[model samples]
Target: MKPPRSLLVITVTAVCLLASQGAATWLLVEQSRTAALATAGQTVKRTLGTAAANINRGFLQVDALLSGLESLVAPSESADPAGPNRKLRNLSDQNFLVRELMIVGADGQVVASGLEATRRHPPALKSSLLADDALPHGGLLHGGLPHGGLPHGGLIVGDPLRNRLTGEWSLYVGRAGRWKNEPVVVVAEIPLSNIAQLALPETTTAGLRVSLERTNGQLLMSNPHDARNTGQILGPVSDRLTPGGPWAVVEGRVSGRRVIGAATPALHEGLILVAQLTEEEALADWRETRRVVLIASAALAAVVVLLAVGAVLYLRARDRAAASLRWSKRLLDQALDSMSEGLAVYDANWTLVLTNRRYVEIFPHLRDVAVPGTPFERLARHAAAVVLPAGTGAEREAWAEWRRRAHEGSESFEQTFPSGLTVQSTQAEMPDGGIVSVHRDVTAAKRAEEHLRAARDTAERANRMKSEFLSNMSHELRTPLNAIIGFAEVLERNGAVPEAVRIDYARDIRLSGEHLLAIINDVLDMSKLDAGAMILHESVCDLRRLVGAAGNMLREQARAAGVLLRVMIPEEPLPVLGDERLLRQVVLNLVSNAIKFTGRGGTVDVAVVRAEAGGLQVTVIDNGVGIAPEHLPNIFQPFYQVDGTASRQRGGTGLGLPISRAIMKMHDGQLEITSAPGVGTIAVVILPAVRCAASPADEVA
Candidate 1:
């Protein structure tokens, strides 16, 4: 009756193998379903969180708009009320969200309204909402308030009320403040439709529903347009709702469909945002996957029943192919990782195909989001958020869009990060229309280039100053030499010249030779000072005597120019320790310059007095055509003449002030000049009191 033992063993073995395969397949399907549900839950959570953030941001903007209206209303009583009314009207026109703007006085009287008709015949507070007494004074609002609460300074966001004038639903924002001297409230009415737009998602995904509700359970808006559901009460509050939490997942019914949903609190305490998807819709993809897997498993079972021996051979071949593929992938990854530059490749659809380690290191924030199938736009947005400075959402969006366009182009470009690293990005097109981008850090090279440019500019400026100095010196040297030569030739020739004429020629030649010698001496002194080779020949000298001697020397020239020369030396011995010759030279140069620049009948006064800082000051003041204010700072620079023609006509090289300053510096003193264009010039020579002595030592010649 029973089968043979050998046949029974084979049948038992086959049945055991088939049962094991079925159990394994069921376990795998269950794991897949669990993973899929988790992923869907996260998607719903993120979507709701983003929607809540957007709604909060919108309220913040509305609050800002309301605050701005305060300034107009707060000053209306003090200024012309008509002017603020016009301004309110203009503000309402500019902001589409603000349907109406009005100001209420301390007595709850409508002081100014944006609506012209209402302004002509100001309406009383029609809705009892504005007459609420619970509103606080002079603070910002964060949560909802009961009906009939007035807010001062702080924002009061009220529930939607039907506008008596337009017969439309509108939300009111009220801020109380003092206008002129009386208390006033500025109110802005926003249409419910506008608030709904802010809560609605920009792009709706398939099988997803979004609803916005007030704290009182009234539905303000819902996506997918269920007219019967709008303005109705929400089914129930989720037990998972946590105060101040970002978002929470819960099971609820939305628009007559039982669904898994996420709820998040918006900026306003009463406002809640909910995003939902039906259970059937959420599991649709997993169900399809399960169906396909079941069909495949049934076909494989049939094949095993028909050809069990062939199935074993096929499994072995499949294992070998998988091993080879894994080995190739490891090699490719290693090759990419070895490269110095950051490398990333995207497919023709602009979806990331692969990214090396270096790329992730350079943009570590991208590592979290840059998967194999991620779109390039997502990566660009991440970069803008992390690498760029703080900016508005729109600005960041624009920057991301620009980056996308640039990446699509063939040209190479540079991007700079907040870390101060600059990257040179180069993109190449693959044969299949994909792109490979490489980023090279070039911060050091860019810094070196900037340094080189700065050095070049400094060198060029120095070279130009040197050339100018040489040209001025050449002109100065040739003038005196030419005069000396011409006068000398006149004296050398004409042996039968009259005695007076010969004396005059000799005198002229001597003067020209003296001028030339003085120029040469000044140049040599400057060189010695620059080279640190000049030595001070210190001695005790009479300051008064020195001033008198300088005045006497320049008296003849002063007389010739019809300028009076006066010396105001103190009767008391004004003795000083310094090189007498250098002191005399400094005084002579100052006096000579004064006389040369003075007009006819102008006076040159050399006076000596005690300085405030326990020093002796010798001041040479001349009522001459004074130095211009613009040229005063550069007067002590070598070869710097205020007017080249005037300095030449004055018959001296432009080295007088510079040499005098240097001599003063060597004596541990200072020389200062102050002058006005039309007024006279005052040159003060301050010598330290320590340098002064009661008596003169053997003075150097």
Candidate 2:
């Protein structure tokens, strides 16, 4: 006899649950350790930062006191050192850190001594602080300073030396300066213990060490206080602290224990502030957290095992009676929910009998009403709003009738909703005269068809425009070449023609050649802009001068066309940074367009002024045949012409406005044209205020 299948399944499930719990416990412990290390690094940085600030502030105070002693003793004044010495003694006693203060003159002699012990005996030429054999790095010559000291007006840090009176090592700091028209050095002695105390505060904790060391890795002071380590060069000990984010962790041997730490450069030149916390101390909290999580997970796993055992007994007793029925119901529900199409059934009386989840989703308005015994007519009425909702009421009613007829005939039909969802529904007759319908959503397929149609239309339109541009280009190019060739032939083949006639033909050839060159230049300029190869040669330029210059160049063209051209630029200098030549071309192109479009006796006005949006504005208004409202949108498209026939008569490549617009965009500006059929046109060029060297208040152009 085989064991029951439910018992086998229960045993396998219990084993998997326990294994998963164990894996979760390991992950939690690892995550806790990472978080603990990150938190420890930040705490170390804060501690080092505070100690460095305090030490820097104290040294600054000592440097300031030394400056006062130099002022009291002057070489140019009456030669009495008594008053200055008394003041120095008072300064030393007042400041607890200051052991002594003195001023020494050039030629290596003491000018004024703060301690009288040095004034009386002057040990081993104490007056000569800068003896040659005792340079700062060289051995001290019998306890005297070296050949050179600090640079002018900057503090110098020197090696520790024993005080003359106390026989204890003290640090001396000095500064060189000019006092009373004489060069002198002021020096002060500060106790080593006082400097050490400033670095190591009273709140220092166990398993933590804070040290102040030279940039050369020479140890100056340590909090956990080692006496023999003073003045010892630690030799690149910072390499031991491996960087672990915002701070560092001590990895290899720095001593016996590993530490998480940070090293900060102190404000005082050539000193490093270090703060270290032992790794064991930093991980103390993480260890206890891991222990608690492990115990809780183990207890929870045990409770789940006991519950599974009780559930197995209860389920085993009823398995034979209830398993078959429950399995059938569940399998049917899953199959309905997993289907891509909605399903619904109606009885012979036309009352709703059953519906899948998708059926309620497809007809959301009837979700609450779709149940056994609800009339099918009422559900159809509720679903009508989603089917072509924008159509007339009569049309909606006709659609409902169509659906009813299709179901009666057992046929398929498609209906579109307001949400753009297209659904295909098919109804079949059952053996008992009932109906079953399946609905499938086809929104993606319908949208793909619409997109393909739109893309085809755009491609056709672009092809037509390019064809027109090519035709126009060919005619304009041939006219000039034909004239030049015809005239040159007359001059060469007919040398017997009169000299006056030949001279006239020669002039025509030159003018025709210039016209041909102009056409080629326009095409090249447009090509450069299209390829993004044009670079603006930016400089500080007067925009007013540029606009005025453009008007001058086109004055003759306007006059030849029998039109009045008015230039209304103010005399104020319009300073802007841009390519001066390109800016002139933009202004020239707009004004030329205005002049060409205006009829005889029409007016074309060009003006430069401040824009309302705190920028520069150039406006060209022409009282002539303006563009129609519908053609305004395409004016900035390359080689686009509103009236192709009118453009041929005006003699242009239809690329002027597009190139001008591109140039404006490069300057971070814009060009706008507003027009009506016969009311004339207003074309404005706006330059952003950022490009204007002068503000709107200053009347920038």
Candidate 3:
């Protein structure tokens, strides 16, 4: 290429531009690579860490289960040697994960269980109970035993159940049971496979190779190993065993693929647990990042080349540039001063050379303290006097640090003043040994945050008070209302009472009072719940008892209203954990509402069904007048009714569903209502299942 008139200018511009572009490109490339590596490492760390954390959590749950086992098996608790107790039953009922709970004595005998009798003793116990090597040592023991049914996968959490006063190993035959032949275990199992299921739900790595081997170099379980390879040596056991050494983390090429392996020794067992991920698979994220970085670097280089060409042409064309430089300076100053943030300029000696209007506005105290070209020490002293005392100790130190750092060339810092104002200060060192500093206010943001916090606290407190007041009021009012309704019914049923007057007066008194009480009770419960004073007392209760009681109580009302009332309880007893009284009330309310809303001769049906969400569902279906679309939302509000006057005539407090909803929630349950404008409404109550049927043996011979 022929040399141009501005060859020197072109060369200098190109060098500077290329140097800056190269620096930017290198920074971008390194940042992308570092970020990808960080993300991949974090994914692996969290996956493994969460699995280990869950395993530890399972230990806690096992402790709780074991602590109560002795009491469940005591002779006083269960007369039959293998019969269950309330506590043991609570385990199966309250916890859904436990397919079967059994207390294995020191001798490994199956003492008590939660499964049916036929399956409970089905030739499974002969191995663990008879074999010397079968008793689990404790911690997490993963594998199949000679149980021979669906894999008897289990975790053995070996904690000694002790007497409260004696501090002795109270390992006794307490509780046992089986359900659905699902893999039953002691406590909970936190297998790597299960952890992978949660952490990589959609990943095909589920089928990836994994291995768990004993310290003896024998494989316990391995995805790549066959059944015959289990407990068989693929490598020398002694060489593989680290034996209380630090966990092994190895990365190397294996089978033409890079693999990362991490191994940790089991604390409870001597076995070593190992995890491996192929580097090609793990680092797949790097390819796309590299591609983007290369493309960006090429584009940046092209831009710098074009900029250099333009600067070269301009340099020769701009022989006289002092006028342009002076104009640029005036423009820069005007722009800085016009900005909202405070701006000030200082010389190398820390003297104030320039101050914008905002600078003067921010530091009013410095208005008379410092004149143009005065030393900055005057302004610093004024700022410290105005802001230091109002700051926290750290804030004050941070402010002091900013000034010190500012005294150093090219340093930038920020600080919060005593007026609840945050100020960000930037220092730009000038070529002539001067500095420019700017301050921007951030106090509005701080005030807004404080206001939001105050509002949130106020709302939370109000809700708590409302719930507490409601619960307290419910307790106080129920007593007298119960007496009034009871006496009224008794008098109306007596043969001695005059029939004509007794029927009219008794009906009116009982109906009016019960309706009023239901409303009062509902309002009180809502308040109590809002106040956080309501507590749920959960226990296993028969679904039949709840449905039957509600049906019987509402039968007369249904008949009087010319409505057909029917209840369908499962042949198998539905067991749920909840307050019996509250549950019964919920059923009664739904049924009663159906009866009241149904025109004469309408039909109302109630059914209890077991649900997949580990709960019993009580559904009340009715062919009544049905709710209006617009009124559905407000139907559950206190004292609200679709037809207020008509609902009054029907003698309802409108608090029924709302109170029922609150009670259901207390039990970790909820009430759902689905209604059609004319077809009818179905109210469903969901309660967590607490009772699992005692295995067949307890029921049969």
- Scored by lDDT, model 3 comes in at 0.59
Write model 2 residue lDDT over 1-701, tens digit each, in one string.
35468878887888899889988888989999989887887778777777778778877888777655575555435666487777777888888777777665554455677688756633222322334342233212232333354343345555555566676556666666545555666767776777767766665355667877766666766776656766677765556542222576665234767788888776666667788888898898889998899889989998989988887877767675676777788899889988888999898988878889998787676778888899867766666656756878887787777666777777788877777778889998889989898988888878888888888897887898889888878888888889999999888898799989988998889988987887787789999998999999987788888888888989998999999999998876888878888888889889989999888999999989999878899999999889987788998888887774555687777888998999999999999999887779899999999988844525443
lDDT of 3 at 647: 51
Q: Specify the highest-lDDT model's number.
A: 2
Which 10-residue span in candidate 2 carries the lowest summed lDDT?
134-143
Best by TM-score: 2
Error of 3 at 645 (Å): 6.4
Q: What is the RMSD, in Å, between candidate 1 and the native fold over all Cα?
A: 34.0
Per-candidate TM equals 0.41, 0.54, 0.32
TM-score of candidate 3 on Cα atoms, chains taken together: 0.32
Candidate 3 residues 1-701, lDDT tens each?
24455767678778888788778878877787666555544444444454345433543455456543544445553366445533455675664333345544323333445544413442233232223343444211123333544322233322212223333222211112222232223332123333233323333542234445555554544444334554454563345334333322244322445444444554435444544455566556666776777788778888878887777667746743754676788888788778999988888898887888788777777788657878776666556767775667677566656676676646556677656567777778789988878777767776788999999997795676456446544544565577567767778578587788677766667775865666677767767866988776656667676698789999998998899999988766555556777778788888988998888988999988877876668899998878878888876665455654445446544567778888877777779898986688999887665433333322321
Which parts of model 3 have CA positions greater than 4 angstroms off? 1-511, 643-651, 689-701
* Reference-based TM-score, model 2: 0.54
Error at 664, model 2, angstroms: 0.6
Question: How displaced is residue 104 in candidate 3, in Å?
Answer: 86
Clashes of 2: 0
